[model samples]
Target chain A: MKVVVQEALFDPWEEVRNYQQQNLPRGKHGGSVIFVGTMRDFNEGVDGISRMYLDHYPGMTEKHIERVCEDAMNEWDIMDAYVVHRVGEINPDEPIVLVAVWSRHRAMAFDACRFIINDLKHRAPFWKREQRPEGEHWVEGNTADERAARIAS
Target chain B: MKVSVKYFANMRDRMGRADETVELDEGATVASLWAKVSDEPMPENTLIAVNMEYTNTEEALKDGDEVAFFPPVTGG
Candidate 1:
């Protein structure tokens, strides 16, 4: 299990390769599921998002992510899970976060990956502010009701 | 008692500082601490954490605790 929080951009494919090389020798992982979250040029129908600034409570961010991944691992039959989130200023089209899970079967891998991403979205401590041509604005968060509705759908 | 209060994102911008130490009565809760710090109304959906854990406004605070307040998380 590994959780990383940094200001530098990371290569998702390289991260996966590194994880496989480091952990495959220890245990057998038949399948791997990965999710890469990227910054977009628009949000909530607004356009021209040139840059995004991500801020996190340093010590707490990593701990929260680790806890989320740990919960997923405990609930599912998975070998390992990894999460990496970027802080500082990021441009559109750059990756923001990555979540990967390894399991003996495809089913567990898929479910665990999804669970980690969803939980991270709702539970993590990172905040985002968007910079655009008009002005900079802090993006509002998804309310619990909205999250519940999304999960139900 | 004293608690280290930290602000992030817009909270920091609005407060014009990243962190500070505030004196409080013994056993003050997050809600009262927030009231003591900012004069304006707390933003809707604001999130609070105590000692690196997600906590509620009613949670009792301890001396030397690190309290963080910020807007709701918007990250993926």
Candidate 2:
């Protein structure tokens, strides 16, 4: 398991490839599930967001994500998990996060990947301040996980 | 006793400082710590962490502990 919280921009594909090469043995894992979250140009009905500043509680943010990955490991029969998240200034279309899970089969990989990302969205100690054409504003809250909400009801 | 209190995101702006050392009575809970720091009522969505771990306002705070207050997390 690996978790990285960085300010530098990263290539999600490269991260996935490197982690698999270094960690997962050849033919050891049959499938990998990867999820990448990117910044959108519009939010909260505001369009043409030029940039975004992500503020994170440094030590706490890492710890929280690590716990999420650890929980995924415990809950699923996955071989390993890798998570990379970007902090600091970001532009539209830039990848903000990457969550990859490897398992002997695709089912566990898919479920664990979704679980990790969903948990991170809700629990991580990170805040976003977007620079829109109108002005800057702190994002008030995250949108509900529609599928999860429906399932829980 | 004193605890170091940190604010993040909007809370930092609202508090007008990133961090501050706050005085508190022995066995003071997080709620009382907030009472000493700010005049505004704590928002219902306020999130708190004690010593870097998520906790409630009623969690007992110790001397030299680190407390953080922030709005609801909005990250992905």
Candidate 3:
């Protein structure tokens, strides 16, 4: 399992390809599931969001994401999981996060990938402040993920 | 006893600062520490992390502990 918190823009496909080439064994994994979350042009019923400032608790944010990835590996039969999340200022259509899971079977890969992304969405120690046309506002909350909520409860 | 308190996002904005060291009575819990710092009651869905681990207001505080307060997470 690997987790990276960075400020620079990343190519999701390149990250997946490189990680699989360097880390995964030959022919050992049968499937890989990848999920990329990107910044939207609009949010919370607002339009033309010019930019977003992503703030995080330096040490705690990285640790929280690492724990999320570890939890996913523990709950599923996945070979490996790599997560990369961007921090600091971001523009619309930029990738916010990447989650890739490799497993011997597709079912495990799918389950673990979803689990990691959902956990990051609801639990990670990152906050968003959007610069809309009106003014800057802190995002009150994330889009509700019932799966994450169920797991939390 | 004394503890370091850190605020993030909206909490930081509302508090008008990032972090500060606050003195607390011995055996003070997270709830009382928050009450000492802010006048408003803890907002709904507020998140608390003690020493970087998620915890509740009822969790007890200790000298040199790091406590963080922020709104609900909104990240991918």
TM-score list, all predictions: 0.93, 0.98, 0.95
If you assessed candidate 2 against the hidden native complex, which CAPRI class would it receive? Answer: high
lDDT of 3 by residue, A35-57 (tens): 99999989879999999999999
Ordered by lDDT, highest first, the candidates read 2, 3, 1
DockQ of 2: 0.91
* DockQ class, candidate 3: high
Compared with the true structure, what per-residue lDDT tens digits does model 2 show for residues B4-52?
A: 9999999999989999998888989999999999898998899999999
DockQ, in order, for the candidates?
0.80, 0.91, 0.87
Kindly report, for each predicted structure in the order presented, the TM-score of its chain A compared with the true chain A: 0.91, 0.98, 0.94
Q: Could you say which candidate leads in DockQ?
A: 2
Q: Candidate 3, B42: how far from true, in Å? A: 1.5
Interface RMSD of each: 1.1, 0.6, 0.6
Clashing residue pairs, backbone N/CA/C < 3 A, model 1: none
Off by over 4 Å in 1: A142-153
Superior candidate under TM-score, 2 versus 3 = 2
Flag the better candidate by lDDT, 1 or 3.
Answer: 3
Which runs of model 3 end up more than 4 angstroms from their true locations? A146-153
lDDT of 1 at A151: 77
